[model samples]
Target: MRNIFTKLCVAATIGAAALVAAPAAHAVGVTAADTHPEQATFTTAPAGEVSIQAAGDGTPAGAIQWYKNHLGSTGWQGLCEKAAENSYGVTGVWASANAHWNGASPKHTTGTPPAGSFVYWNISAYGHVGIADGSGGFYATSVGGAIGHGSSVSYFNNYRGWTPAAVPHQ
Candidate 1:
């Protein structure tokens, strides 16, 4: 009986030690703001206009990659438009007017946008656009003074809303 009791105590001590040493479990579906505090300090502009670059190949993943690749690029006045056009094929559309793209039939909403959705803001006459990260975060131009990511839509002034990608993903 004493031997059995000793074994159980040892097992309990080991279990307690393991629990103390275990890393904290991260919350599922946590927003960027929750994980990245620096993203909360995003900067905004009325237009964030730089210069137009090449349009993307009309894929949400590609658009996201394009934004990630150009993280520190400046002079991209059309970065927002370019990102949306790459994924949605809505060329020649302003950031604010992308919702009306012909035949796209976008469903605009003022709530949290899904990943790969096109987010918009009423920043300037042209407005602003960005790609959603699905978890209440977005990747866009003029964040922290260049192409970058932000934690929340509130980081930008006058958030207009969001519209899903032109093509539905399964």
Candidate 2:
């Protein structure tokens, strides 16, 4: 009985030591490829504005192209509006419902903004905006602590919605 107890104590000590030496688990960041449009809940834009499903280029390849070119860039810290303006060539890309670009009013929606669309969030007085990668993810400033790609619109607070790529209205 004495020998068996000694062995059991030794085993328990080894197990405890292993547990203490184990490394802590870290959180994995979500990528654009990991998201799906079907997983999102749809919502309509506010009154007088166009619906994301109703106007603009449903697929703004340019946005994606721009995102790819600027991926991992940290130059866009507080320039979320400027980034959107430069990428889409639209002015007054504010955080409110009045945000418009090049005479085109933005359509809004929650969850899974279409690729190349402008994703907006109400994080500040001016608001935050990023370009969607169409894979249920977005590219924006301060993402992952810098200008980069984020896996969801929910990455920021107060998700206002998204607008299709602005096209010059006739």
- lDDT (tens digit, per residue) of candidate 1 on 1-170: 99999999999999987842312332222223323345544333234432223224466665665565556555453445654554443445543333433233465656788877777766554566778878898877666555677888777766767878544221
Give every collision pair in model 1.
Answer: 49-77, 50-77, 51-75, 51-76, 51-77, 58-86
Best by lDDT: 1
Supply the TM-score for candidate 1.
Answer: 0.56
In the range 47-102, model 2's lDDT, one tens digit per residue, is 55433233222236654555455555556556665556555544344532224322
- The whole-model lDDT of each prediction reads 0.57, 0.56
Off by over 4 Å in 1: 1-57, 87-104, 167-170
**Which candidate tops TM-score?**
1
What is candidate 2's local distance difference test score? 0.56
Give TM per candidate. 0.56, 0.54
